[model samples]
Target: MLTRISSVDHLEVKQVVFSSVLQLGDSCILNGFSRALAVQRETEIFYGDEGNFPSYRIFKKPLPLPPITESISFLRHNINPIIKVNNIDVTAVSNSSILHVGNSQTVSMEVRVKHIRQLLLEGHEQDI
Candidate 1:
């Protein structure tokens, strides 16, 4: 069992128990079972290394869900977060927007089989 405060939404995390949810909270969780798409802004430069690099200005717009693969990464800015979960390792590459929690936030979560194995092995089945 593990716990910590998430900087994303200031939610208390109990653990990383599944692929859908990167972290678990009392009310909701951060999910990563799907690929998140973001809007991009392109620009043209006339000077500097712009000639050597790709001649396009790429700015990934902030998204509701940060783009993450393998581990947690590309979290949007404004969402100051600290992920705390046991046996979970996340790597973030870019920063952009905030993941908001409003009145419409859902509470249901899907637990992963791997998380279940870890909990039972550690004798914390009650947590499930």
Candidate 2:
């Protein structure tokens, strides 16, 4: 398998709020050009809790501005992500552009994989 540190990136938010949280989904899109990186045609996406920077704060009102501490981190590890273009395993990020913090050591994914059986969907119940 090809090893690459550049498969993913990060984004910082004032707090772990709704709109920001939704940005983590599979088809989530961010509308901005990469400042100085190889330009890819499709919308770019960042992933994992390694990229979460939550600024926490308690307000007298329902919502607060300029949070104090980081909270509610979301991270995911994927060996064989279904994304058609690239498969990635996001580790972590902070105040940097595409920071790489994992090992470059090569390992076989085939030897360790366990098959997951899919359950069939039927209109009527069948006798076992």
Candidate 3:
């Protein structure tokens, strides 16, 4: 297989976070995994209590999904092998994401996120 890229004028990538990949060209296999936990509280609370949170415990455990068993095939017939690209502008790629250009054989990605928001008022604040 022959791949010809003419030009890439401008490419702006802001952020690539949490087990992400930005690949250009041919690839045989790509695998990515990410896990995140975000907690927001109205008032400052005890940092040590984070371990008691249920969501925290879940993140500690391994992913509880079955294994992947699949097969894939690709056949490419190019009449004009000249690939032209003027410009590419990207904002963000996050959380086990992949931004790939050209040929790829296999790609796998997984992401898990847990968000908790707490807005509780104490006894004095509740009266007001």
Candidate 4:
């Protein structure tokens, strides 16, 4: 979205709001050569880039939901924070770091399979 700010000089400025989101973990490294999409800007909250990277990292540790039950207990229990590490010197960093939560989708699918397996394993001699 292009937000035009009109100042006294009628200057037009731009602010972007990304509709899509990407997630990354701490000490994750990726080169722009692999990602064809032109990564405009990268931001982080924690003290990312702890490895002295040469590539820009998008997000620090993103929280993934549990395998079966979607609960916020882990997040609440942990003191790790969502830091804002924006306006980075992209050319200077090769890797990014962050506090990561568990993978949500994978966990959910695993839980579902386990549940169905349990149901099927139960003895069934009903005549209905």
Every model's TM-score: 0.16, 0.13, 0.66, 0.13
lDDT of 4 by residue, 87-115 (tens): 32222211121122222222111110011
| Full-model lDDT for every candidate | 0.32, 0.29, 0.71, 0.26
RMSD, every candidate, angstroms: 22.8, 22.1, 4.3, 23.9
- After superposing candidate 4, which stretches have Cα over 4 Å from the reference? 1-23, 27-80, 92-128
Comparing 1 with 2 on TM-score, the higher-scoring candidate is: 1
**Please, what are the lDDT tens digits per residue for candidate 2 over residues 1-128?**
32333333443333332122212323222321111122232222333322122311211124224655866787767676432324334333222122223332322111111222333346423522
Q: TM-score for candidate 1, please give it.
A: 0.16
Per-residue lDDT of 39 in model 3: 81
Per-residue lDDT of model 3, residues 30-106, tens digit only: 88887776888777775676645454766667666777688878997877665555677888998899887666677
Colliding pairs, model 2: 48-75, 49-74, 49-75, 54-70, 56-69
Worst 10 residues of 1 by lDDT: 110-119
In order, how many clashes per candidate? 9, 5, 0, 14
Model 2 lowest lDDT segment of ten: 107-116
What tens digits encode model 1's per-residue C-alpha lDDT throughout 17-128?
3232332443443333322222222222233432222322222232346554676557455453445333433443122212233221443322211111111334544554
Question: Evaluated with TM-score, which candidate comes out highest?
Answer: 3
Ranking by lDDT: 3, 1, 2, 4
